[model samples]
Target: MPRRARKYAVRTTYATNAALALVLAGALTACTGSSGSDGGEDGKAGDSSASPTAAEPGKYRTLPKPCDVVSVGTLREMLPGAAAEDDGTAAPSAGASPYEGEPTATYDTDRRVGCRWKNATSLSTRHLNIDFERVVSYDPAVSDDEQAERLYAKKARKAGIPLDPDDTSPDADSEPDPGSEPDSGSKSSGSPKTDSSKKDGEKGSGHKGGTSPDGHTSPSGAPDASSSPEDDVTDSPSATPGEDLAPRSLDDLGDAAYIDDELHTADSGLHRDITLVFRTANVIATVEYEQWVTDKHRIPDSQELQERARELAAQLAEQFED
Candidate 1:
């Protein structure tokens, strides 16, 4: 009899409940070919002791010391009028040198990188409003997808979302109530009696329409519960109040992803690309960075670079906060 193959299976479900409720289902199967007496029906019995090892410590090491700095000063300088460039070009300043001062100083080529800013206005009324910082020992080899998954898992756990590795389907019953408030006067069928204006000499005087003796209408009558100020304090899915007001720090902002094919180049070795997107409220921002890779290096590790990109995104997100 032909040996049977060994199969591993995984099932996934994503339930979306909002204006609409949707349930997505998927399955993944990985099969191993049959093995023989020397190994079993498949290559060998699962080697519990032969678990795959992680990447060697610093196997793809980044520099301990800071590398050269690429001045974003030019980006800052051109930011003011960047919205007016009709040709979609990062037009170079009339008189500027590609190489000047120290590597720590920015090389202002008067050109924009992966993303563009439009209708950018700041409290200072400056043309360009985005700000950035320099980082050293940057590497880009890490998989941003993994990073994003980690972030999702972290957020899900924080929000009390069930995350049982043994169970793929989310606990549907655990979802919070997303319905509107019940009608306030549902239990009160009869209207309260209204009192007419009292005589001037009366000690207890009141007016119609539920006006109090002090002549102030009750809040419940003036502002219906549905239109109450509390209704306006609803939690917005897009706002991050703490993050917006907190002082900036160097902690990991999170993971981000970008496709290499999306990169554009102005000069032979100078390339720029937008790598990540951030949204706060209705405002969206795209972050791009410039790179100068050598001919010998086709692709550099970008994990650290992406980490920095996320930080920049967080900073940008802060701008839209109330």
Candidate 2:
């Protein structure tokens, strides 16, 4: 019970109480942080909202140049005597020929591209246009290939070409036969003669048989029996002059392909328009070839136009692979 012993005891008790209070404060601060509160005891954790979503990536990150999609050799093949691209200048006209290749405008050099060529020969005039498109998908749920396929389907449908029109689709092949019509005059005015009719009556009926399917009537009621049957029977209906062009699917070109052909008759001559479209992976290519024949007496050949357009398509498609 001395004064010194009492003073020391009091100081030790105060120091112990202060140390216990500091430990309790430190434990509370850590608990608040681990509790997942917006503002921890330290108040240093700023806004803690969820992060923005990330975008999906496309298959092809780069596209080829549109102007150089086709080679100079192919361009020459498509348009004989056509000038080639020199540096940034177009080739000069040779002997007044119009078949020259020229690059078209491109809004985005990386995404879209186009080229054109034209020529006028003594026999006919030819023109060709090619376009290339690179597709990209911005959706997280869809892929680049899927997006390209969707666009391809839309283009194919817009072309109006029936898919697989050969055998399964009858609408393309089936047509009302112009020759199948029954002769009304023969049936109404003239009576059906018995097996043994008067020779004079038979001869007279044969001469008066009005008209054939082709509007050319013969002595016999039907087409000339001596002519080949194929001459009268057409495998497929031919395109009539001035008829709207219908799209037809083409095989062995690319993943998918089609062609649209239109025939026009003018005072100057007969002309034809042919369009070919093909898709490969993430790129879709289109080629447009138009022809004008100087001689109205001759009709423009469809096979020739189709073949040339297809060749251009194949050439353009090759660039996508690179």
Off by over 4 Å in 2: 1-31, 37-62, 80-99, 163-246, 265-269, 294-297
Write down the TM-score for model 2: 0.53
lDDT winner: 2
Q: Which residue pairs in candidate 2 collide?
A: 98-119, 99-118, 99-119
Task: Give the TM-score of each candidate.
Answer: 0.22, 0.53
- Rate residue 259 of model 1 by lDDT: 15
Error of 2 at 182 (Å): 53
List, residue by residue over 180-202, the lDDT tens digit for candidate 2: 22211111111111121222211
Output the lDDT of residue 161, model 2.
59
Q: List lDDT for all candidates, in order.
A: 0.25, 0.50
